[model samples]
Target: ARLLKQYQTHLKKQASYIVEGNAESKRALRQHNREQIKQHPEWFPAPLKASDRRWQALAENNHFLSSDHLHNITEVAIHRLEQQLGKPYVWGGTRPDKGFDCSGLVFYAYNKILEAKLPRTANEMYHYRRATIVANNDLRRGDLLFFHIHSR
Candidate 1:
């Protein structure tokens, strides 16, 4: 939420001035991006592994990424989910303002962003074909990969 607030604030001000005013707000907007780097050290581009061709290609061709779009899709979802960290886990609840269950959290995060029509139940997801089959090792950012945790 802090990130979104800063982003909106910056956008509203950027066109109004050409000086450090927008620059300052831009810094604030980027604070979340910096925090994301801190939170995910492994994903951060570094010098040591720069020789790996796959990493090199991915870094070189972040073709769709914008400056503000620094985070992976999963990081964005994680950031949204982090806002609900202290809230009570309510069964069958659907919104952040109310509360959430496991599926509710998934629903709230991906519904509008992904334009996905996910079923309300957790297990029904596997029955749906909208979800692409991704191997564990092939998981990419923002993927809604699931795992079986226990017997019901």
Candidate 2:
């Protein structure tokens, strides 16, 4: 327990540092653009949105959000599960290499690594969380998948 807490603390601190670095990177980029604007003020259109452009460019980098603590947690969970990749498929087993149904896998994965115990069943899991539905373009690693199994 103490070791787990220490690990979580270290992860949180690293995540904070990463986020701070990302922010600094963005600030630097914006400053660079502002310098460009200052140098060529008459060449570009009026009322520039340099800030927006810098955000869009920074957002294009996948690693940009890996600094987020939530994202880091998801990444760590996925990495841990990847270590059990060749496991057999049991009807409801949650143990690694022994197989697992969908819900069982999810439950075991989160509980074992993330320390989060999600409910069982696809429908239950689908509705259990308070996540907003995001477009495919907005999906990220570890995003939940939902389907209407019985619907048209």
Candidate 3:
């Protein structure tokens, strides 16, 4: 349980870093655009609303799982992982019969319950497009975590 908690925390941190970097980049880009517009008002007729429209569309398309549903999914995954506590770690294994690797373990546990299939490897999971980065304090059961091991 402790190990699982640690993994959850690690995943939250990785996601937060990615999210923070994206927000910072967006802010920088907006500032740069503002400066360019100020210098050449004639070149820019009106402010861009494309980004806003994209965000609105994304929000409209997103489906949020209810708290109860989320909790049930988390419990199920954790239970599955706990059942394999003594299993050997295999390099690319994804099932109990063959043992399980890090990402494979996560894939097995949450993939079925989740709307989208997770990437088979940690690196890909870290960069998954649909991933949402929650605040550290908001980390809860069923959160998938990614960590850099020896720069891998």
What is the lDDT of every predicted structure here?
0.57, 0.59, 0.62
Span of 10 residues, lowest total lDDT, candidate 3? 57-66
lDDT of 1 at 54: 41
lDDT by residue for model 3 (62-97), tens? 222124434555776788788889889999999999
Candidate 3, position 58, lDDT: 26
Best by TM-score: 3
RMSD of 3: 14.2
Predicted candidate 1 versus true structure: per-residue lDDT over 1-111, tens digit per residue: 665566455445543443233645645534544454345443333423434454334333332233443343345567777878987789998888889998888777755
Q: Candidate 2, 128: how far from true, in Å?
A: 1.0
Local accuracy of candidate 2 as per-residue lDDT tens digits, 1-152? 44446557766565444223577786775565566445534222344555776544533432323345455556666666676677777887876757877777777666555433456776777776433577999998876788877889
Tell me how far the alpha carbon of residue 134 in candidate 2 is from the true structure, in angstroms, after superposition.
Answer: 1.6
Error of 3 at 81 (Å): 0.9
Global CA lDDT of candidate 3, please?
0.62
Candidate number achieving the greatest lDDT relative to the actual structure: 3
Q: Model 3, which residues run further than 4 Å from truth?
A: 1-64
Clashes of 2: 4
For candidate 3, what is the TM-score?
0.55
